[model samples]
Target: MGISENINEILLDIKKLSPYPEKVNLVAVTKYVDVETVKEVLKSGAHILGENKVQVLTKKHDELWDYSVNHKWHFIGNLQKNKVKYIAQFIDMVHSINKLSLAQEIDKRAQEHNRVIDVLIEINLFQEDSKEGYDYQDFLNDIPALLTLKNIKIKGLMTMAPYTDNEDLLRNGFKKLRDLKDELNTLYFNDSLTELSMGMSNDYKIALEEGATLIRVGSKIFE
Candidate 1:
């Protein structure tokens, strides 16, 4: 199937999972894909695209600036401090902010650009050895300090489930993220922490079922 067909099919499947499909944001992951394919995804009505690396995102942002005016670009990978400046100007949101220092750097760059950057707090739900995110208790303990930052807005939480075929583990991971969001909302008494940026191509349906408002899918659409 073509890019357009794949997107259409994914959108259809998303609708089946929720009564209000429009609420679920589909961020088409464009990492490792060509600009042509990215354009095809945009042409197919997908307005949000995510990239895992700043260099690639920068190249594409420059090359496709005209085509990207109406689209939202997201940084969905482990971001290095030095690379934050490169993406601060154009990235719509950063989905993997795992530490206060990184968030501070992002805010510094965003202030220089005179833009308020939106970010999601990445939670290490399963305590994976390889993942980058804040542990549950640490995140809670740091909320007050995080709220003090001026140039960045905390939109919500993000998480990655372990790569496995076990349905129970996947669902539990997603559910924990949803529960965490709920806990934070009640603690803060605000709904501004609204986005649950969980899920990927392999397990988006489960993510949606567990209350993921934003999902990132790549190979499923681009390959």
Candidate 2:
């Protein structure tokens, strides 16, 4: 099957799991693909594209200028403070605001661009040493500080489950993220936290079952 077919299949699967399929955003991860492939993805009907690197995203944004009005760009990797300026102008949503300092920098850049940026606080649910995100307890402690940043709207939480075939582990991880989002909204953000960027190509189905509003899928769609 081609990109279009893959997207259709994924959308169908999403509909199977989610009652409100329209609310689930399918972000086609285009980090490994070239501009031509990305254009094909957009043409295939996956209008929301996610890029991991600032340089690649900037380059693709320029090359795919015509799709700007209809498509949106999401920064899905570990965003650096300095690199925030490059994407601030066009990034529709950032799925990994990992630290307080990074949030401050995004706020500054968004202010410079005269636009408020949408962002998700990345939570290291399992305390993985390899991951770049706030520890679960740390994030809870810093909620007040994160809320103080005026230019970036905290959409919700994002997490990448460990790459394992264990279905139970995946479901639990995704559930934890969903619960955290609900807790944060009820206690701190007042139900404003909406998007849960939890799923990827590997465990997106489980993530969707648990309540993932945004799922980042790459190789599956491109293959």
Taking all chains together, each candidate's TM-score versus the true structure is: 0.96, 0.97
The deviation in Å at residue 207 for candidate 1 is: 0.6
Clashes (N, CA, C under 3 Å) per candidate: 0, 0
On residues 124-194, what C-alpha lDDT tens digit does candidate 1 reach at each position? Answer: 99899999899988888888988898999999999988878888999999888988898898897277788
Task: Tally clashing residue pairs in candidate 1.
Answer: 0
State the lDDT at 106 in candidate 2: 93
State the lDDT of candidate 2 residue by residue for 22-52, as single tens digits. 7898999999998888888888878899999
Stretches of model 2 off by over 4 angstroms after superposition: none
TM match of model 2 to true structure: 0.97
In model 2, residue pairs whose N, Cα or C atoms come closer than 3 Å (at least 3 residues apart or on different chains), thus clashing, are none
Error of 1 at 208 (Å): 0.9
